[model samples]
Target chain A: MSDADFSLWVYLSRTPLLWLTVTLLAYVAADRLSAALGRHPLANPILIAVLLAAGMLAATGTPYRTYFEGAQFVHFLIGPATVALAVPLHRHRRTVWRAILPMGAALLAGSLAAMLSALLIARAFGMPETVLASLAPKSVTAGVAMGIAGSLGGDPALAAVLVILTGAIGAVTVTPLMNALRLRDYRARGFAAGLAAHGIGTARAFHVDFMAGTFAGIALALNALVSAVLAPVVLRALL
Target chain B: MRGLGGTILANLPRMIPGAALILLCQLAGEAIAHGTGWPLPGPVLGMMFLLLLLLGNDLLPEPLPTPSVTGAADGILANLSLLFIPAGVGIVGKLDVLAQYGLGLAVALVASTLIGLAVTALVFAGVARLVGRDGEAEDAA
Candidate 1:
């Protein structure tokens, strides 16, 4: 490459703006493609965007840390975005309140099942204890899952990865599986999606329907509480 | 389109205070959770705090910044999926673990997530039916 081109590359790579722009552009492209495909479950915008961004980083030989310096701005929003969920929850308070009994029951059952199933499966496969701990809270959102995993003597980063994967799997499967079960109750569908997949599933729920989205947010919030307390307790019982 | 864009731009300034309120709630939540050794995450607590304000907004003499926060929040939540991409990309860097335990990890994640979803969904549906809320949920839907 020419010196001028190389110099330009060096400057752009170091700037946070470049990767930040790439993250947005990649999401735009993915969203466009997903929309084109009628927002099919498999055409998940996140899976597409992450792959696109990761591919560009690898192709350009950019370090993940350097890329994150720019992308972290976007990542930081997960916190406020979470807090913003209260808006919808408040708006749909009546619906949420009406479903309170079901929500409580589902939250306990789902939280326990989600944590226990992963730990049991991982153990049967002979995964290490630390890895099991990391896998236990995979259903919680990334930030909370990371903390829960860390407290349980697991690798937080590993927990984060598992959480994302679990979300994607749940997001993709929720619609088809719910349809097959003939479940027309958006509340039940959304509650399950959020309970099992956290934010990613909640994101998918929002796309499918509004009521579903609100219930998903409620489930997400409640599950974070349940899983945090439950993960350590469940781990102790199993170990 | 142009008019909507202009409106969004005009309303952008008002969003700041509302956004700040959200951040403040999150900050207070963080302090409480960390200080008191709570198991809950700060943002989740912040969510509950915001809900309380919303519920009691009528009781306040001047009213809280509900409209502005709604605008800010809707904007944030609408584009929520975009926020996950950065951390999602971190996956590429963590490929070694994926490489070594691909099968087990794959099975564990998929199986657990699906089982959890099905169990929770069925339990909710079944319990809601018994509680007579399933019909209401359907009618509401």
Candidate 2:
């Protein structure tokens, strides 16, 4: 066989292609099982996907880069996807306008609280400054968080991981929290999920209701702005 | 012939701007980050910048000047999960970082999310009242 053929097998062996493929398939299977069990929030697709993928990587000894290479296609689209959120916000312009002042206040207060609380807790635990930077923007969407991390001198990779974990956890807890608080409005529930979790939580909210999705999209965008503004000033002081 | 040509011409101008708007925002966001030497990404700046533009231009009205923009946004968000594949793929390279830092990372994530939820809940509750929706009316609304 030619060097090319030899090289191909070598690359495949070193890479975690089989493990990731299995993980993705396992993720789909778990989702099917969860849906059959009646849409349990504990069985959330994001949560399942993450846990299963983590397990597979650990079991197979496949490196993360290899899986990422096979999976980066998903990452590339986050930018356009985020931009798309604008369409829904645009569609709800009237409602958005009617509640602009309230939404603005909520967005600002919620965002500041998210950042400050995360920073303080991480500090109390004696987490490194770099890790704190990554956590600083975790509440925002991944695309924005990654950018903010790079700008603020946080590890972008760590930020991306935090962003994913944040989304997954937020997606899982949103419904339970809403029910507990008696937040029945689809818009409020959705906005809260998306603002707290970003895209991952928004996806979960969308599965529950369209109004929730709309609110989540609005929350996602607004939080991105608030986090961007808050991360720098806050990090400067903390760092 | 005249109608066919006019149709394509009309769509061509509209479609180009819609596409360009997204690309421009992504690029501008990255550029601003680069220029300012801050941690902010270019696309984020693009988003905020777009919001400013929208506020100025009424760019987000229900009857957007063009349907293509809405369609474009829809197609992107619907399959947003697909975009994470690349980032997930990047995880392979960062396993070492993840391993060394996983616990701290997990703690930060859970903590921030709970904080985010509490803050959101409080803000909405407080704002609902301050705006005179009040607790009773808010529950009703």
Candidate 3:
């Protein structure tokens, strides 16, 4: 409010450190809160952090681009973290290898279902071509989904948002849905969540159990691979 | 001065090899995808590459020292969800598009996701049963 205070705000906001610190602190707080709440899927730390960061940015009138400048460091780690998924897959090699047939079948079926259902529902609603394209890869991880969306003439940014929402929705609904279906297998549960929700879902699976988390990671990678190849081809034929 | 700051600085040098290995794999993946014009993302390919490297190491006469690799990878995986927050916040920027197509998008997302999850689980369960794997029972034990 005061002139000195206003000057300080401008200087602080201009630095990359502000957003970086904010993102880290917000996520840490959300992680603790999620833990305190017993890691319920609805209390997803990423979801909470996103809300908190977005709210802070909006309240301070800081542009998303400015916030991203600092936050991109965290984003850059996704690549390395993705590569790290290989560690778990390596650990669970025998299980994955033995179930290769079932996993493959599920991947193909799930990928097609994800693409077709989105395309049909969006088409039925008479959404635009771009929106339809964006929705096609909604079940894949954000990075791969966005790429697929872009190639299919969809809005990549919208695809990213849709991917996040799908992950959140999948995380929240998976436990109840699986329980309702009497699905007790961690492999089945984790794979289903990964196929439906991608990274966030995989994270939720990990929280549930170590074996589940391992399969979820496997599913996340394979689903991304399968969907990337299938989405554009299917969209071409359908749209 | 010799406390938190020095300890972190001391650890910094040790973290580089692990971080570098990950980055190198990612770069190789990017290069391969770029060269082959594959539809896959570099990181995804990079993951496959890392898997192959690990597999290859499995057959070696003497395994390579990879403390840094495990350290870096574990550190990153431990907080993997944090990486998603940046892009997630970009949702705030797309409010207009969301406002326009919020209903359609919501319907499609929720419906397709549920369908995908259900179908995948049923199919997997069925196949596992046929194979007599009883993955659920195995996991429970």
Candidate 4:
């Protein structure tokens, strides 16, 4: 509250390194906490880290853009990380190849189910057209979902937010739901989570087991492709 | 030449080769996507490219010289969730939209995600049963 303290705060917030350091430190703390909690899906480190960072930003009155200037370094890793997914895909190639037909069928059915249910539920609640369009690709990863949302005349930024929320919701609820359904197969559980939740779900699958993670990665990539191609057409027909 | 190669490998970080391969694939993918006007993102295309490379390696009589990509990828994948936090934090800026349609959006997202997962899992399980090849068995093999 003092003048000197206020000036020091303003000076430190101006530099991008502060946000970058905060982001990493928050994640480290949250990751440790998640481990301490036995890696429960609901105690997801990313969810905790984001909340801590957002809280810090709000408290300091630092703009998202300013925070992003430093945080984008971490964001840039997503592309290469996605490419690295092929390592797992290659390791499990035989399993994936053997079920190519079933995987394709699942992709089609799951994509349609995701799009239709999202639209129908939103429409039932009388959501606007843009929100409906944005919601159409909510199951896909953020980057692809935003692109699809833009093409479908929706808000790309909103689509990104929705994609993250969808992923978080999927990650949190999937394991319990799978257990209740008695889906004991890791491959089946991973594929279903990936198809429904994309990257975050895949991350959760990886935490569960390596085999599950591999299938989840494959499902994430294939579902994105299928949804990208089919969502616009489905939206056209429905709208 | 073999001695030199060994020396370099010993000195270099273990993650470099895998990271380099992934970045190389991403760059190639970006170039191809941009040049060909593809609808897919560069990273997705890069994944396919890597897949093909792996398949090609399988066809060769000799094993590829590169270090284990899986090992390298494991390092990154372990912290994969952390990479998404920055973007998730951006949601703070969209408080108005969330405030307006928060209930509807929440209902739609949760319901649709659950339905999608259930449908996908059931279909996958049914198909796996028909095929008579348990994924766990294959995984063990």
Which structure among the candidates has the greatest DockQ? Answer: 1
In order, the Cα lDDT scores of the candidates are 0.88, 0.69, 0.85, 0.84
Put down candidate 2 lDDT per residue, A3-74, tens digits, no spaces. Answer: 999787667756556545655575566566666767677776656566666666666676676666655545
Tens-digit per-residue lDDT, B48-75, candidate 1: 8988888899578887557788988887
Listed per candidate, the RMSD to the true structure in angstroms reads 2.0, 6.6, 3.2, 4.4
For candidate 1, the per-residue lDDT at A205 reads 95
Candidate 3 regions exceeding 4 Å error are: B1-13, B136-141
Predicted model with the maximum TM-score? 1
Steric overlap count per candidate: 0, 23, 0, 0
After the best TM-score superposition of candidate 4, give how far the Cα of residue B55 lies from its true spot, in angstroms: 1.8
* TM-score for each of the candidates: 0.96, 0.77, 0.94, 0.92
Predictions in order: chain A TM-score: 0.97, 0.87, 0.97, 0.95
Clashing pairs in 1: none
Candidate 3 structure quality by residue, lDDT tens digits, A1-239: 99999999999998889999999999989988998999987899989999999999999999989998898888778778888898888877877777777788887888788779888988888888988888888888887888889988999988988899999999999999999999888888888888888989988898888777777888888888888888878888877
Model 3 chain B poorest 10 in a row by lDDT: B1-10
Off by over 4 Å in 1: B1-10, B60-65, B136-141
DockQ of each: 0.73, 0.29, 0.66, 0.61
